[model samples]
Target chain A: MNADFLLKIDALSVSFGGVKALENYKLSLPPSRILGIIGPNGAGKTTLFNVLTGFIRPDSGHIHFNGQEITRWEPYQIARLGISRSFQNICLFGKLSVLDNVIVSCQIHERTSFLSALSKTRAYKKNEKALREKAWKLLCVFGLEKHADRRAMTLAYGDQRRLEIARALATAPKLLIIDEPAAGMNPNETQDLLDLILKLKEKFNLTIVLIEHNMNLVMQLCEYIQVLNYGRLAAEGLPLEIQQNQEVIDAYLGDTNNAGSN
Target chain B: MNKNKHALYLMISMGLFFCAVYLLDAYGNHYYQRVSNLMMIYVILTVSLNLSNGIVGISSLGQIGFMSIGAYVSAILTLPPGLKEHWLTGLPHWMSTIQSGLFPAMILAGILAAAIAFLVGIVILRLQGVFAAVTTLGFLIIVKVVAENWMTVTRGGRGISSLPTYTNLWWTSAVAVITVYVVLRIIRSPYGRSMLAVREHDLAAQSIGINAPRIRLLAFVISAFFTAVAGALWANLIGVVSPGSFYLWLTLLIIIMMVVGGMGSVTGSVFSAIGFTILLELLRGFENKIAVYGISSIIFAIVFMLVIIFHPDGVMGDREFSWDWFKRITPLF
Candidate 1:
């Protein structure tokens, strides 16, 4: 248990049968920091997130968050422990309204269960009002308050991406992992996304881990960076040092054919 | 009126209408009354299946297994003395008690069926698509086979007969109304929303801290339980039970009614089930050829194909028919 460290992965290794997905990986960070992970398409970035969040338990590793050993925790368990994640593909509930989607994500704070919702108990009504207000404010922060009543699946690509962030933030997570917030965005939208990320990170006091291929966003936004070539760390340091690191340059930026590999 | 007010009025109207039908049956010819009893049972079957396929999106065709469990449990328990002797059975002591009347037997049958479904859900629910369909289909076959070979209790291929025709319109219609309300209530709860979330996206639901597997299991079991009680009512209404009672054809037909009506739509399921059942009940007098067209067995297949092809969001597409919306939006006539 290392409560002082907002997140820590100790000696993590994941293997899918014989193929190694991630190996002997380790990192530790406190709150109010952004860690960017960049690697090729198969560099095990998503696998790392899965391991930390218990979507896939590593064959060997210990994941500690806010002072609890959480190696084999389920995805829901990690979430309840205040760690939240967004998938590489914006995994919002497509059939629900955007506002409803955010409210569902905030179930961590909802006191009522399915039984109580049927009866419309006082706790259910009171808590639901507060949760809806919270979800509305989150959508407002992301400039999505106007679209709250629309189906989440009907959102245009940019709003969908922004709504994913809003939904993730609704969890009130201590640590948030976003697979790729800037993917599929136009340059202008990407900049808007970056600005929104900075605002929300400060507003929520969150430690963020981002997996992104956009060099500009990574270089400008992350305080620390971890680079991977093929499931193993290629380099780890400041953004300037990473841009100049000979190994990172030759490995990640080397292949023009696999451009945007991460 | 608005959608909510419309729905509220419709619900109130439906209650009054069904009650009037029950009262009319009390004074009507025996044959018309019997047909109404059959329609009420179909209402339960279709409405309960809607909870799974419509709201939760499991897309099942194995509900006959649950119904079969209900049928055999209720029939065995409620077998009158002559029928019991003819079936070559020394009744289980518990069966002796339910032979007393209709409500107890149906209630017990529903509970028994739900318990089986709850247990089976724990085992086979992790499977989706064809694997789940196969598992449940196999379950149905096993139940039928047991009914055949266990002649001492089930009367084998000859089936159980002389079942007391106690499940008249009064009680059957009551079950119909209650089951539809129960399933409707289920889909509107947090549990219902979580099941819908899982259907929409399993990883997303879990990512949001909803327990996906558990929610699926709950919906699956509850649907099974209610469907089973409907089966018990059917067994009594028809006054005959056989190995042929719960064939795959029936399962396919149930699925068809659900699909044509619109999977995941309460109003759709109920309307389709009643229309399909009444149409078939009429067609049974027309001999063999037209029966296929009249029965949902054929209609469901076509509707299912089209639903999957064009209307994959289903008839309702996650939208509850909101009486509240009706109240807000409707123009006063």
Candidate 2:
């Protein structure tokens, strides 16, 4: 019931046929804060995101966004309410041009009717021009302007990741959730992505909730952090506190350390 | 500035197309004129089907159903009241007394077909891939069965014939031009972009606020409207309406044209429809000389197999024929 919180989830639970994917998950996020959800593989990090974005219906829960209950809203409705996300796997419109990928996201806010588009009315033309310019500017931000006309699938791996983020940003979302933005990046590219995320947060005044396996990026970027283990909230605190919490380290961070050593 | 330049090029192309059609109408033999008219109708069918199957990535096998609905609706409406009363004695008083011009009948036919598509799409568009394709094929069978059994309205399998020959080269060409223009405009618009996104990845599209089901339904309904209009034109041109004509064979012909032309390319669909129609006519001539039955179908099947083997993405592969391509090739010539 906190009026200042931008997103509130309470008593959220979802289950597959016999196994729980998420159980009694809760989050209260204030505006303009970066929250990181870190967990081991199969720890339900993505399942939580799926529920929050309305891609999956919770078995039992309540979600309030901007003071409106959106527990049962459709994915597009949730997105239009100013929540946008990038996928864990790269999911660009493979056959569409790089510019077109962003333009399609920008089109969520388009006001012209199909009739106007068919007739090429002045309003439709102006709106279309504005959308194109906005998409082009976004591509420019990602250093993709040179490849705007190329199909998205033709881009190199890192560029495709950047384009996904650019496409997500084009929706003008208040809450941006990116999953594993540094998954396949080299150290140099990861550094650039870290800087880009910080810059975008400042430029758009965004509330970002990201799920990352890269601990260094998570620790540097997140103001608050939550840890999940076996579909339950294992720890929630400031980044420094979560880094030192014994249960979280034993449940998740220890695995990363062991892997690094090996 | 570039947008205006492209528009100018489109206008010039349309102008040249009409001039060519006019020359054929004035000087070509009746046989060639009729074949060209049929080609225009197939062009409309192929392009409209491409919107659903190619661009939206929804494989629909029910286009012939909508076409049949269009054909029957237009035929019943435009048939002279005296002829209707004499031929179809089971018609209701209101239906038997009504006689309309070709234009209004065709428009009504399209509207009716779109309405049916809207209802049907709500239920079936939820299915994806081959399931959706099979459901649409079932829809075609249902429509065919209804037409065959509804003796009062459709006169059953015998069909309505010889009432009028209202379709000509002008009507067919004008409608075909409008179909191409409208589909092209749609492909460049926001809605078109959404459709393409949904086709690429449904989850990604939904994440970005593109309503996947709604976008798919829009494509289906618009495609059905145009297909229905083409059906109306075909019925008027041939001066007959039969359930048998709107079945699997006709569906296969239109689908072949779409597949060979490249599913997602509008220009590909147009050229392929024209190319295939002419090829079929030439094959028919050969069939007549050899006294062979079903030889044209066999040849086309082989041609389709060859195209699939060598050029699986069709002639266009989601790319349009741009003026730049024309310029690039001019040097080689």
Report iRMS (Å) of candidate 2: 0.7
DockQ of each: 0.62, 0.87
lDDT of 2: 0.92
The best candidate by DockQ is 2
**The TM-score obtained for chain B of candidate 2 when compared with the true chain B:** 0.96
Candidate 2, B83-145: lDDT as tens digits = 898877778889899987778888999999999999999999999999999999999999999
lDDT (Cα, tens digit) per residue for candidate 2, span A1-262: 6789999999999999989999899999999999999999999999998988999999998999989899999999999999999989999999999999999999887766878989999988898899999999988888999999999999999999999999999999999999999998888889999999999999988999999999999999999999998899999999999988989989888755567676
* Candidate 1 chain B weakest lDDT stretch, 10 residues: B291-300
- What tens digits encode model 1's per-residue C-alpha lDDT throughout B1-333? 455766678878888977788676768898788778877888888888878766777756678888987887778777875556555565665554445466777888889878888787777778887888788777888888988898777788988888887787877888888787777776655566677788888887887787777777788888888888888888888878888889877777777777777767887788777887777765565536554544644554565687668876556554556555544676551
- Place model 1 in a CAPRI quality band: medium
Q: What is residue A229's positional error in candidate 1, in angstroms?
A: 2.0
